[model samples]
Target: MKMRARCCLIALLIILNWAQQAPATEDVPGVGSLPPEVLKLLQDLNRQYGPDTVTLVSWLLDAATHSGSVLTASVRVTGNEAREDGTFLVFQIETGLIFNTRVFDQSGRLTVLWSKILAQAFAHLDTLQIPADGVMIDLLYHHKAFAETDDLSEHVDEPGSVEEAKFYFPGDPLRAFLGKKLSSPALLARTQVFINDTPVPYGAIRTETANGSH
Candidate 1:
């Protein structure tokens, strides 16, 4: 009888261990359950890049829309169907603002391709009745290639690297930046550039600079 009781105790302990190790389930919403505008934007992106290539990886929405209140969405593109492979696209959901950090070509520079992608996202987001003035763009630049699992924050604070540039502008300034006529200097003048969380003058970013150095 003691042996049988010991066996039952061991079984109980095993069951308890398994229960502790099991993942807890939460009521997380699926991609399809996103807001109608957001869902449409994702669908349009998927169609543009081929079916099942674009996936909504993560998002944070504002509890209530207010100035400086931000909603962000992180999207991943799988396969080489588009030039955005291995890159994550982050969007300001409220303002239709978007940007990506991945360097697309051998030039190792931010290119017009980003502008085009931003335009596409903005077109869909413009339809939403949200405050455009609160829209801001925070761009991350790095010499290293980002793996699919890499966290962006890890690179932002790396010493000696000017990894971030932020711009606070309404739709018109953004439009001007996207337009061919507007020069980068004008955009830079309004931009608040940063290096390792330290603020730097916009002029520190030069056309010929590499590795985000002045």
Candidate 2:
């Protein structure tokens, strides 16, 4: 009888251990269930990169709507589909948004934010397939705290002003991208020009030479 009890105890212990080690869906408010594949991919991404990547991904998953008009949905990462153009990952941000990719690409704010985020965590990812929707939706509406802006135009010093002039980027998403890629003033200054609908310029230097007698 004692041997029988011992065997039962061992079986119970094994079950308990297995239960403790099992993986579960991450708890995110307002977010729906994530596919097992997506959860696994997220773990891999977090392990390879860091928490920032995870945080950004989490926000994307949890975002439900923007401005009460644009709809958001749970995202899925599917296997790469081979193509002659290039290899790419298909991130289906829900079936609803797939047709609207073109609209979203037009917004300056959204494009800047999306480009910056991708560069930080997914730099190695050369090609990506998102929803075909052409609207920016509400990706950054509530996450503005993460978005930053520097209006250095007002701080530009006059010809004789003692104050040092500064370069400012008015775009919030650009600021976030700069904050991630640039660690020093020199790097930021080097990237002062970028092409948009037109050439956007930042920073100006005024030089004066003393008169010389012939």
Candidate 3:
């Protein structure tokens, strides 16, 4: 009797945890699960890179429509594939990525909130695979408070302003891929650039003076 009770309790806890970590469908059904454009982009990405190289760098969510819409998605790592030799996929938000070879068997595969994953991914970048549709990849979404931008007021406190910064990016997906391997906090901390605050003609500074210190 005691063993049966323990098993039942464990099953109940697992179900509760799953429900909390991931909702049935989209958080809000009417919102329509990421716009057509967004879905197209994700499809193109999966088709192009085979879900091994493309990643979600950062996600930006806003209270719009019924619930929220993925505003912008940023991808940090990209390649035809993770490289024949294979490479590491870095997260812009936190650190590590959870990998699932059989992604579809799992419903909510993308779930992880840890900084250690970030450090390890970067460290062992040479040998790792991005989980496919059925595969699972842990990410840093719950600990969003650690990121400065989680709070609007806390944004832009780091160094540069968004407008002044110019970054080499494939696309911004902070809004599209929040809890996935491609999106990471650490990568975002390094990638985002406030372009407005940047000096005009940054690389092409005029050499009017001999020093060229513009």
User: What are the Cα lDDT values of the candidates?
Assistant: 0.33, 0.30, 0.28
Better of 1 and 3 by lDDT: 1
- Sorting all predicted structures by TM-score, with the top scorer first, yields 1, 2, 3
State candidate 1's TM-score: 0.31
How many residue-pair clashes does candidate 3 contain? 50
Candidate 1's C-alpha runs over 4 A off are 1-130, 140-165, 208-214
lDDT of 1 by residue, 1-214 (tens): 2233333223323322333343324221333344566445444443454221221111111111111111232223222211222222233222212222353321222232123333333332212211223233444433445564655445444412324433343445445544533445555565444344466655554442233221
Alpha-carbon shift of residue 80 in model 1 (angstroms): 32
Q: Against the true structure, whose lDDT is highest?
A: 1
True-structure lDDT of candidate 3? 0.28
lDDT of each residue in 58-135, candidate 2, tens digit only: 333433222121223343334344434333333333211211222332233233333332223233322222322111
Ten-residue segment with the worst summed lDDT in candidate 2? 158-167
Weakest lDDT window of 10 consecutive positions for candidate 3? 60-69
TM-score between model 2 and native? 0.26
lDDT of 1 at 56: 15
Candidate 1, residue 183: Cα displacement in angstroms equals 1.0
